[model samples]
Target: MKLFQKLTPKALIFWTIGDQAGKVYLGILGNLILIFAIFEPAKINYARVLINS
Candidate 1:
């Protein structure tokens, strides 16, 4: 989807930076928590919206 496509590059950049900065574990954990807390609900809403439209 467009949302994922847009986010992919940004995520990759952040991951690369985090790796180089030696915060890979922290970044990964934070990203996982954020994905579960935020993106999960957003993704469900997006799917609902798409289905409705």
Candidate 2:
């Protein structure tokens, strides 16, 4: 139970950071596709994002 308590916050923080990073990643990806019409670059990123999510 002590080990679980120690890890819980660390796990929560790690997940929060990961969530924020994914949001920023998708925002950039959206800008590229919408503003620049750059599908090639986003396609690569999209694949990785899909794998992650």
Provide the overall lDDT of each model, using Cα atoms, as 2-decimal numbers.
Answer: 0.85, 0.85
lDDT score of residue 49 within candidate 1: 100
TM-score of each: 0.38, 0.54
Q: Write the per-residue lDDT of candidate 1 for residues 26-52, one digit (tens) a residue.
A: 788899998899889999999999999
Candidate 1 lDDT? 0.85
User: What is the Cα root-mean-square deviation between model 2 and the actual structure?
Assistant: 13.7
Give residue 8's error in model 2 in angstroms.
0.4
Candidate 1: minimum summed lDDT over ten consecutive residues — where?
1-10
Model 1 RMSD in Å is: 16.7
lDDT of 2 by residue, 2-38 (tens): 7666777879789889999999999999887786666
The parts of candidate 1 lying over 4 Å away from their true place are 1-30
